[model samples]
Target: MSRYLLVVPPLAGHVNPSLGLGQALVRAGHEVAWCGPELHLRPLLGAGATVFPTGSRLFRPQSDHGLAAVRSVWDRFIVPYARFSLPAVDKAIAEFRPDALVVDQHCPAGAIAAHRLGLPWATLACSTMDLGDPLAVLPRVHEWVLGRVRHIWDKAGMPADEYFDLRFSPHLVLATTSRELVGRDFPEHFRLVGPLLAERPDQPGFPAGWLRPDRRRVLVSTGTLADDVSARFLRAAVAALAPLGDRLQAVFVAPPAELPDLPEHLLAQARVPMLDLLPHLDLVVSHGGLNTVCESLAHGVPLVVAPIRHDQPINANQVEHAGAGLRIGFARAGAADIRAAVTTVLGDPGFRVAAARVAESFARAGGTGAAVAALARLTESPVTTGPSRSTS
Candidate 1:
């Protein structure tokens, strides 16, 4: 059986999309293992996922939002992260020595290491692929991101002087988002198989007894990275939804400290089993995270998005453009605007229709099956079909 090594970054949302595909590969009789951040990622990858530590630093961003965060990401997170994991990834190649590398676009060290070893590798993007395209709409950000990748590739003896879009593989680009959520006109090279809504084994369950059988249930969360601005957003959500009173109930997944102050109308938690909860939720007030957005749509739950940073603004715009939700500014979203948006999504049948439409697309996109087929085709071809070989 051919072994496929997955190179992923530390991000939970990013690694999540790979889970279903890894399971699919395993079921197909191909060996699958992980080479990602150190120890803590083990449990998250689930049982049977043989994971090797990439010797990556535990990078927690000191700045959560704004221009400072952009600078922090470049200087502190991405560049330094690439440096920290470089040797570990190369070591993984020498030790584990898989047939092909299935790499998350965020993990550049793996790509460079694969290039240095002359091994075929496919870029598995669990995030927005458009951000890393050579013809990126945000050219400056593209150049900056490539500059970081070039630094590591140059060190690894690959010619990194030229520009390369590491996000898409020449062999196969397996993306979770389809045209419905991300838009049409994606590069022909990309295989958009819709979102991988891979359910985790352990779900954080809530007190189902607390729900009033008659009320519309809504969920509020910023997904995995909520520590940055949970307080501000949670408060606004409570204020916004308070008027619903006996008519609506909002469940908030937040840190322990942020729970007590929640306006009398909401239930709060450190975390929740989102997949378990989505079916009951009529509306989701989120930070426009790609995973949450897709999951909400998958369950036919409409949304009210407050885009905080990074690709969130883009995803929120998609929700708005799709007529599935309303968008609000994270910091500037007052109680009034939040309430208005929440009411619009919850009260309107059109929003639910749009969300169900997105759900239909996700179903037809074939999730893990589509992704594995693409990988299997690339693996069987035995050609050097990946970024460095194609770009070079």
Candidate 2:
């Protein structure tokens, strides 16, 4: 048996994947603990999990698009969070004495701490952003991010000559995607373990009976994190789906506050058991988040994606390129455009066929079980001292 510590951010998308991996480790007779903000972790992890709390802060909210969004993430959140969490991570390592650490790509402090202590650690690539270097086309923007990373590295008092990108682990990298969707080759160290989808806590009181046998089922969600563009896009979605009431039923993952005047055929809720509901869905209208997109494809459900910010555009493009979905402009798409995209995905049998192909690829790549074996391998390997480069 080995002890594994997961260093993660407060955000749901980042922490959710680790839940399955951590649970699998425990089930395999290993000890697992988390290092993150307790407020968010407690609910998601339940009462039994051990957590080394890192507290919380009011970082700047990301609400921009394109290059601005990329800059906002690094300048406002990632860099500052790294500086703030480094000490806590070091402290966790001191007390827990974990055999290996599993760090998320977004939390560079975890990797830095592991390197400082000569501990074996693995990187968790939860999205497509870090995998293909998608921002390589924008040279200046890419350099700007590197500069921010250097700032954190220098502040940690590490040797300037041994500078390495802390976002990637030297030993192993677990990506929550498949090569079929990535559409590219990856390094041997990088394991494309598909989505780590464990059974999440159920969101009770969902009127499952509301789903009608006569109408096709569609789920419209922009994800948990709210943005400036989501409000307008959701309103447009409501208008688009309202007219198709007779043919299909649309369920929006929106609170009553967001849409007070929802019609009879449309349902609005603050939360729904997404994993539990995906099997029943025929089509998904999404903001192109990796989790939602992969989950939809994993269940062989087609999609109509409107990318909002960050890595969403890339994920949406991957969906379209794979022939599993269609992409529409998030900022410019109106009711007609959204309705047209949704209708096209549902009308085309080819889209469903493509989705099934992606699902098969995900199944072949394996999910939580593959990730568990990778982490176990890391724990068994010798812990190397100092900074070393791994294919990122």
Candidate 3:
């Protein structure tokens, strides 16, 4: 039994996977707590878990990427986030005295703080962006990010030049997705722990019986972070599904009050426990959020991905490459394109087969259970090895 701290950002996508890991760790007889924003975390994590209010608004859910999303993430978000959170994490360290830290890769502040304290930490890769090494091919982009990491080390007042790559952990790096979804070429130091699958904390009463028994059931969501992009896609989706009439029914994740009137066959909700809803769905049309994509695959439900920003385009490309779904341009795809893509996924059995095939891999990856074991091992024997060079 050890006391472990989870350092994370307040973003829903990042926190969701960590929640699964927390749940698994607790069940395994370890004491677990978190460091992030209490306001956003309470509803998701519940009052049982202790949370330290060290989070900053360094993360934006939606960005126009006028500055380019990657550059914005490093320059505007990650660097500033780490700079401000250093003291807060120091306070937590003094009070909690955690044995090890489970840190989200995006929250470099936690990583720097853990390193300064000489505490063992594990880098949790909730998304494929880091594991895939997307920027490695671009020499200039790679150096640019490295330079930012260097600046943060100096600005945060930590031993300058002591830490260069905060994205990786010296002890261990755990990826929540399996090789089946992300492909085999991941950093050797990184362990593929699969998606930390947990039941949605906001499990709303679902109208499972309401789905028309005759029609193909579809789930339409843009994830919580994408309001504007989703609104546009929802409007287009409404038009695309209109022709199906009684042949198809769609349930949307949205604000009921803000949503425009939709067809009778379509229902809008502020939120629903996706884990609860996935079982009833034949197909999912998503904004390519990692949680939604992995959850859909875990249930053997195919997807139709329309990417908006950030890591979504890469995720969409992976889904398309895996033959689990079709990809469409988020901003450019019209109603006709939406309808055709959904129809293609539904009519073809290959898509479902592909999804099922990945589902098997997800189950075998051991998910949170394996993740817990890896983190526990870190405490028993401190890891001195550097990160693995993965070109995949």
Give me the candidate number with maximum lDDT: 2
* Stretches of model 2 off by over 4 angstroms after superposition: 386-392
lDDT tens string, model 1, 14-132?
77777777888887789988887756566667765788887645676554564455556656776677777877787777788788888887777777776656677788776563443
Positional deviation of residue 84's Cα in model 1 after best superposition, in angstroms:
1.5
Cα lDDT tens digits, model 3, 17-58, are 988999999899998888887777777887677898885463
Alpha-carbon runs more than 4 Å astray in model 1: 60-68, 129-138, 160-163, 226-228, 261-265, 385-392
Better of 1 and 2 by TM-score: 2
How does candidate 2 fare on TM-score? 0.96
Name the top TM-score candidate.
2
lDDT of 1: 0.76
**What TM-score would you give candidate 1 relative to the actual structure?**
0.91
lDDT of each: 0.76, 0.88, 0.82
